[model samples]
Target: MRPGADIQAFMGRLGYEFAQPELLIRALTHGSIATATRPDNQRLEFLGDRVLGLVMAEALFKADKAAQEGQLAPRYNTLVRGETCAAVARDIGLGDVLKLGRSEMMSGGRRKDALLADAMEAVLAAIYLDGGFSAAEQVILRLWATRLASIDDDPRDAKTALQEWAQAHGMQPPAYEQTARSGPDHAPVFHITVRLDDGSMADAKGAGTKRSIEQEAAQKLLSRLEGGQ
Candidate 1:
């Protein structure tokens, strides 16, 4: 069933009053919703993509004083990547409020990565529209503060990247199991197990951000599998 009250409560929990409530509505509204209602989020998705890049670029610029093209490029790419944003958005309550089409709803569009990522970007654009640049900046920074802080630092983001790396190497890639995620939402530690395609497994503990730790864990797992340190 449609969870309008649940969505309202979710916004309440996020501590942001949606001045343009329709903006949030649009963010939560999917293509499925549009066929029955008005326009879908496609245009908003395009606009949001640009807006997200601009916001991340600005954040990167402000955060890294000595960042050059080489270092800044990866950070910028990672910050705006659909996978990363989808993970972050899912961590929030965005996944819960999706209003999907009946066909899409049955197909589980609500849990799909593409849908989740776009919703996050659309939500950012909505915030930008509602409260000018500064208001949007504040909200974006608040959400992306960790990514902003870690730009200049050379840290390992092992788990997901490692899988991608393995896949690039023509390997079937690895699987990660979240053994645990402790602490509050803002500060959480993850224990992820990396399992190779050959049925071999390696374990590692990562500190700092979840993505960072996962990468570090993957690196360690890769090294162990490859007979390194």
Candidate 2:
């Protein structure tokens, strides 16, 4: 699709036409394509991360009136975490509008989980700046509606759940190793493998920080174990 057409279609999906389309442009620009004059979306991603955290925190607080701080904490983390953000981005087709450098584009930057997640947050920040908090909140709540409704009140993160499972079964804790790193430094792809003492293992790939990759890998391994795979 044409870039402009893709952007307009993306705006329709987001349910908010940008008052300042430049903000949306900047949000869709990756660091690889950025120059001294043309800025990237990193700053917006930072702000958006905070915005997402606050919205999720308040949401969890209100949704679980009887939940203690400890109980609500994991749910909040699960909701605002990078993997979750990327999933939302995919659901909303945010990747199609992403502007990437030649190298990144050739290497599947649009499909990278980390880049998509960051762009998703940047888009949120752009909406916040273009409209206001209420507007951003509305978009986030709508986009994340299904996730919010099905969120566990006391969710255990994948890494923690794997560790607990290993301990319970008298196995060593799951070990994660970074198998690969690709794409540009600004939007790197991480490939990780998680292995249990019993030789069961699973591999997962994601974009973003190594820790997030490990968490995803652990989750995959856990799922395999539970499934008797």
Candidate 3:
């Protein structure tokens, strides 16, 4: 597709057309491909993080009238976490519009969760800057509707549950080893192994961070142990 057509399609997916199209362009620019004149999305990502957090917090508070602070915290984390943002980005095909360095593009950067998540946040910031917070809030609610509807009132993350389970079973805390790393430097994949003291273990790979990959492995192990797999 032509560049203008591609951006138009992306705007349609994001549900917001930037008044300053340059903001959208900057939001999709990766650091590896940025220059002095063409800045990356890092600053936009920072602003977007705050904007998203505020939107999510407000939404959660209004949605759960009876929820206490403790009750709301986990749901907040689940909603704003990088993994969830990456999923949202994928849902809107954000990767296809991203501007990556040659090396990054060659290494499948378009499918990398970290890059997609960051870009998604930058795009949110762009929307906020282009229109205002109200615009950003509307976009977030529409894009995150399914996730918002599916949250448990007080859900524990996999890492926390895994640690509790290990302690309960008299095993030392689970150990996570970085078993493998692949892909280009700009967008690497992590393979992590989570092992119990008794030698039972699980391993999983993810396109996000090492910590996220380890959490995924732990979740898999927990599911297997709980017979939910």
* Highest-lDDT candidate: 3
Question: Which ten contiguous residues of candidate 3 have the minimum total lDDT?
Answer: 1-10
Residues 97-125, candidate 2: write the lDDT tens digits: 89899999887788778899999999999
Candidate 2 lDDT score at position 101: 97
The predicted structure with the larger TM-score, 2 or 3, is 3
Tens digits of per-residue lDDT, candidate 1, 118-138, equal 888887777778777777677
lDDT (Cα) of model 1: 0.72
lDDT agreement with native, every candidate: 0.72, 0.90, 0.91
Model 3, position 141: C-alpha lDDT score: 96
Ranking by TM-score: 3, 2, 1
46-91, model 3: which lDDT tens digit per residue? 9999999999999999998999999899999999998899999999
Provide C-alpha RMSD values for all models, in order.
7.8, 4.7, 3.3
Q: Which is the winner by lDDT between candidate 2 and candidate 3?
A: 3
Tell me model 2's lDDT, rounded to 2 decimals: 0.90
TM-score of candidate 2 relative to the true fold: 0.80
Which sequence of candidate numbers ranks them by lDDT, best first? 3, 2, 1
